[model samples]
Target chain A: MIAYRPREVIIEAESWKDPATAGILRNLPGIPRRTVADAGRISASRDTLILARYRGKFLKQCQGSGAEMCCNYFTASYAWNCHFECTYCVLQSYLSGSAIVICTNIEDFLEEIGRTLGRNPDRFFRIGTGELADSLALDPITGYSRRVVPFFASLPNGILELKTKSDQVANLEGLGHGGRTVVSWSMNSRRIRRSEEGGSSTLEERLAAADRCRRWGYRLGFHFDPIVHYDGWEEEYRDVVRQIFSVVDPGDVAWISLGALRFTPHLRERLIERHPGSRLPWGEFVPGHHGKLRYFRLVREEIYRKMNAWISDCAPGVEVYLCMESRLVWERSLGVAVRDAGHLSDRLDAAATGGA
Target chain B: MNITDMPIRDIDTANEECRISGELEAPALVRSLRDIGQLNPVVLLERGGRRIIVCGFRRIHAARTLGRESVPARVLGPADFSPLHPLEFALRDNLAFRPLEPLERARALDKLEEAGLLPETIVRVYLPLLGLPPRADILESQLLVARARPGLHHCLAGGILTQQSVEALARMPPESQDRFALLMERIRLSASLQRQVLGLLRDLAAGDGASWGAPLDGEEVGAILDDPSLSPAAKGEGLHEALYRRRHPRLTRARARFRERERALGLPGAIRLAAHPYFETADIRVEFSAPDAARFRFLAGELERAARGADLETLFEVDE
Candidate 1:
């Protein structure tokens, strides 16, 4: 993965007083810092970093369209935007600007999560920090996992899942996460990783990192998301599944997810403009619920069923789930469907915690 | 600049000084010239010992039609103006009266380029002045339309073929363009329909890795064109539907299966069931009309019974 080096840094007046902010600034010594007033003039040059104090509630539900079944996971947004440029990233259309933003108020974000978890002590919470940005991409510089991993370790019922495509797991090596942190990687076939996922870590690098995390007393997870379908996809994905099981023990693996490529209608034009030669947008699609364009139902079913079969063959008794798919699709592909979002959430919680 | 009266015969209208050629007479402008004398003087430049009218071709033509021997003119030496000044002046002067047709805009851009202006320069300077997007693709499309054959140019200029349609047509080979022109002339499709048909054709050709003329060679397309009983609108509708079905076979099959399931359910006329689009969700909407409470209860009971049938379950199945 490409390292993030902000050409310019903007700090809010309030955030400038925080010790974490000062440490971050001191780590990248000699980089200039500006106040929030200069935000309009900073030009958002793709390398600019804005460390503003986020005022909203940091812990929120993933914005899932009710048109499909949601995994019902909570998102802890400490950052926005990513350094790596995946051709089909949703942020290209969701974000209004291109600058990378990291909230310097880590204490306040943790306090909100602690309060929410304390209030619901009886219920298990599966919270993740990778919804809006790569969870561990900037951890080497910020050392945020040092703070967040221990925080979740102290929790009685909360699990923190640090998901990323980068192999930046060095900071997480010595953290006493008490089997609470599930270090996962967003993976795809080598063909897709080479063409679509520019500036991301290689598949072998990510699997090695996952093995290292497992050795460090952390449960491991894998997400085969945005699974692009192309010629010879069966062999491509089967090889990926085989490689995954060969490295890590199935007992240490918590959950594996499969999500086919899906995007909103407007992202098509943006993908074409940003990545001119991308063949991802030329697939036959139909307008799905919530105005998103999805592959034909048969294509999606075939991909999902084949992937589920391959994963099951490689690692028996490993729980495989579909991300943001419909009830009918779950039934047709995996032969099972949780009743609702809450049921799905419970199932994932049980899988992650090993039915504690 | 000197104001003089140059004879209509001496002003060389046949040279390459002006590339804009068409009906130069506007009846309203002619009537205005007759009611009140000429308001703007014609702009002329001296080149190769011949005076050429640069700005006011229409005004000069109007004067000639009025049987006037000479008209008021502003004369300039060739050194006083740059090569782009004539096209710039003509484009700017005519823009004030009315919007330029697509062909006219294309020709103006082409003429500017032919005068040694870079595409970037035209995109940055002239596109905004002519109310076009300042993008290289737009300039390329306009130049393509300008360089097409005269019949296609006429169609483009007359608003029969839209900008998008012409751009799609411009991507095809000349032979394909000729065939498409003949089809378009026979069908006389509206501009929006023309764009839709051409867009579908382009997608089909790209998906098949064949030429744009491949889809047009089908017997069904030819029969639609040859059928005398169908109206032009009907023919266009049939052709577009056929092309769409061919382009998206999976979606077409899914919809057909859904419709078949819908018909097999044998629901009442007052009730309707619509499957969720693309089967992205397993949702089925049941709509019905009831005039009174008794009828509403009856319809509700009928729906409750119909919902228990296996056919209704099949209707909501994901086929794609």
Candidate 2:
């Protein structure tokens, strides 16, 4: 009954001092204090709060463990903290503190990325900043995405994705980013965005922002993650499809990801404690191969059928893919289970090269 | 015929052996035998005194339908084969199938255990198709056999509870499940009892209806469910009975005002029934006409309030 405010949030990280992290820092725009340092080649910002600088080095060292390519398509932004309080968020578990973070080591970071890209000169490298922090959420205060867009525009074999739940696209207007960059928004049905996501843009705001990106010649993508299964989900999702069609043409969309509600068992308690009266039970589930709770095959197939069918009707011919789905599911539900599915790199490569 | 290479004898046949003619049969049995083959064999014991079947009752029936002379038989103690322990052997044989029906499997396990087979061996040698790992498989199977044999069958066939529901049930302590079962039984026994149980469970499950978001105490809930009202509709009527109508006059007036606004807006009356307060923001306006945009904003605002208010503690009913 009382107005709520968060208190004592935990932030966490492992292997935080990554070279790829520097590229994220160098490309960040609108940071209060920004300088291209040559000594140590690491840019430092005094205006921002530095919570922690992780020195550990390891690959794909986080929860939701999987093979390299799928997990590491984008390097860690080293920036953490999300303003939108989505109930089923990994960052809530991953972070050790609640304070906003700004990593300041761009010069060396970009240089390291340059070196890595140079070694594999013929191959394209896809990196993203949205993993640790919302890609565009902090753009107004931090201008991180704007900075990265230009750096990506100049690299021939590099692609950047700035994903967010925010409609803050004004930051992109001044940046002369070509089609080399992607501006993506995570979407859900109106009901979910209302019931689950807090401090995030509504679906219409997101789609409208996507339209703006397309007009600006930027590729757009959508992620329907943590797609909670409840009563009338089919009709609810179809309604979302109708909305998507009402806003933007399908041709401008690069990809769309459909992910079901999945999380560690421990979160069930957290969710029960946090979001009461939440009607999230679809009553069909099994422990997944990854050891997280997942929908039963039948329930999962039902979700896939409902979602894929809606996508086919509304955005025909657009690249529709599943996020972190198993092969058994891929074949039964979508009828497209490629071997390299569980890997994001494989999916990314397929997207880049236009492979189905 | 190198029958030693066979996985087992009579995978899809009855346990007891009997005489059968290939010419006579029922349509369902005929179909099963057609796919799986005749299972029961006539056992010939002790210097081959007489060819008689020790097991495979369904196979014998099917064989009689097909006019076949002999069916596959597992010879037992006559020295090596015995026909005296018909019921025990019948139970053991039925338990061998990977997809044994739940009721039959439970009854068989009960019989097998009484026949001196250790619980662990039955788990290893018997219950593989139950989809449980070796140790857990045994324990869950035994629990299934014990608590709700018929229900477990439906569950295993993926017919009753969804995987999601099972996961939820698995988290609860076994004693809690037992309590839930007892409660369900109480409701099922009588219509009057059912109404009382529904009201009690509803109130209990509502987690105090926005009152500090605490689940009702289990003892209090059980008492409410067990309480007998004057009539069947008595408990149901209590829900519509306004609480503190005289004391919270302003609360009632605000509700009436909201109802009038809702009617004017052409929204369903059901929206007013929510226990928690809800408000929607303007629907993230797309290119829309003024009227549609206004409606969208009103709906979105109401929805925004609902979303902001939802927290985990508010959703789940932790029965004390």
Candidate 3:
């Protein structure tokens, strides 16, 4: 049993350099070292175990305006800074340090989610908790999705997209996913996974997990968001698509989202400072309509055209969409533009609900 | 005025220990001299009892330009063997006021060698400090072309080249020097064949040249390439598509997918667009109005005309 304190005495931790977790600690801003007693509980444990719980607010939703498309999904929790140190993560900019934040109030989070879904039962909300941390990443320590998915299954109007880059789906093996919850994986080409994304599951491992989830009557989705630009990228992406279709049926997938590499300006600086060798952050970019720097519109269209074409060939009926792109981009690249944000939401809802 | 303040006798050019004491005279050199003093002193050497300059010719010119009566100097032995002594000194002197190209350096060296210097002597005395092959290729190539004929030299220097120009040069009864110059110019051949012709041309001139390559035979090109009137940017775009198609023949099915969609929608004939580098890899999802395509086509057209009129001058200018 652990002692719990809501408000603790504040102490500044100057610097933390533990050999066991030195790799992750070095890249963060210097945190002054100090100790807090029973003021607020300081949970201490082994290097692997994460301390967390159900929270007050589970879904952090961002709704799009009518003119823009709403591939805008929700991030449930703020904590869980990744241990993987993937060069592409947006967390490096958002969080001050690598220390994973595990919310101790899980039941409270689920209750809030229950109220939101209850209030807007008719309006479809596609939400997920794995935005900051890999959704199921800290499963061993927190047993998060194990606790949340069952509750999510009870809610019929909304679907939970538990996205991850981890092969830790063993926790969900016997759960009644009921094809209601979508298990999505953010995938990259094998070379990218090997070079840029550290501590993430290999392409084959993620594919195997996706295959397993499909066999167990779960709806699966793949996100090629942050599809990095590199030499020989076309063949590499095509090979991943081939591997995907080979393992799971098109019907098993709710949708596939293609997004070119993009991030907030602050995130770009953090990525470069932390991962100096990362070249993806420094590609040809211009400020887009949304004010975030994006790859030139032409570049986005090119990536969309190639990947959409490959997906259309491999899995003929799977719903293919762009994540957080302009209507012009959609029309120029795919010739399919949602007339409005509502229509975009309707299409995703339809795909998720109709999936086997 | 004190007589002692005046400079004494002009130093003997052939004297190894002789020194000159006046500052450089060129306005820029004088200004620099006033601000920074002389950083590099002139070097002179004696050969056959005549003063020969081993290096610092431009410094002498600058000092002369600045109206200085005499310049400082160190006389070297005829057999001096300092690595990079001559070329380095020569480069520093010539490059002080104006940036000099390798070709121009070759020309300068050519004149000096013609005045009775040996390449072997230059190599032994100056080439050692030029470092490995990476650092030496440009200088060596320049020297090699300089020894060749003017046509070959211009060819290596990226003079106007076309199939016709190449054939004309090839057929010109082989003069050894001309043949050598043409040989150097043909280095651009491999790049052109890979369809990097424009890039090679851009590299040739300091600015993007207004035009390059074989002059378009309007009829032959009309039959093969896209309609030039539609847009040069579009045409330039077509080149990328052509290259992509050439590289990945598998994208044919992908093209078919787009064609089928266009046909089903009852849209007009699809506009030929450039293939992006990632065209075959990622999903292309687009939604836009008719006005967008038209606007994009017009922009592409303007870019194409600019591309068509490209010269080494515009291509190599300091980009904004």
Best by lDDT: 1
The deviation in Å at residue A321 for candidate 3 is: 1.0
Enumerate the chain B TM-scores of all models.
Answer: 0.81, 0.36, 0.36
Each model's lDDT comes to: 0.82, 0.54, 0.58
The residue-by-residue lDDT of candidate 1 on B167-240, one tens digit each, is 67766678887877777676767777786788678667766667877898899888998899988778888888
**Clashes, model 3:** 67
Best by DockQ: 1
In terms of lDDT, the poorest run of 10 residues in model 1 chain A is: A37-46
Candidate 1 ranges with C-alpha deviation above 4 Å: A1-16, A21-37, A45-52, A119-123, B1-6, B15-48, B59-153, B164-183, B186-232, B260-274, B281-320
A-chain TM-score of every model? 0.96, 0.79, 0.84
- Per-residue C-alpha lDDT of model 3 across residues A1-356, encoded as one tens digit per residue: 01111121122231122221232222222533333322124443212223334324567765333226766566687346776667877776666444555555565677787888899878777887777778877665456667677887888777888888888787787887655689999988988888778878888888888988887778999999789876799999999999999999998899898988877777776675677556666455555545566766666788899999999999987898887777767877787867866777778888887632
What tens-digit string does per-residue lDDT give for candidate 3 at B81-102? 3543443455455556464444
For candidate 2, write residues B1-320 as lDDT tens digits: 11211123333333223212212335777787778875444342213433344445555666667665545655544555343344344545444543454444444555556556677866775555343456745555454443453332344343333333333333445654444444333333233433333333433344334321122243433354556852324432332232222222333444455444334444333234332221111112113223577676876565455445533223221111
For every model in order, what is the number of clashing pairs?
2, 72, 67
For candidate 1, write residues A1-356 as lDDT tens digits: 67788888888777877778887887677778778743434448558888878889998887763645887788898999888878888977888778888889999999999999999999888899998889998887788999999999999989999999999999998998988899999989999998898888999989989989989988989999889877888999899999999999899988999988889978976886687667687677777767787787778889999999999999988888888788888888888867987788788898888767
Cα deviation of A104, candidate 2, in Å:
2.0
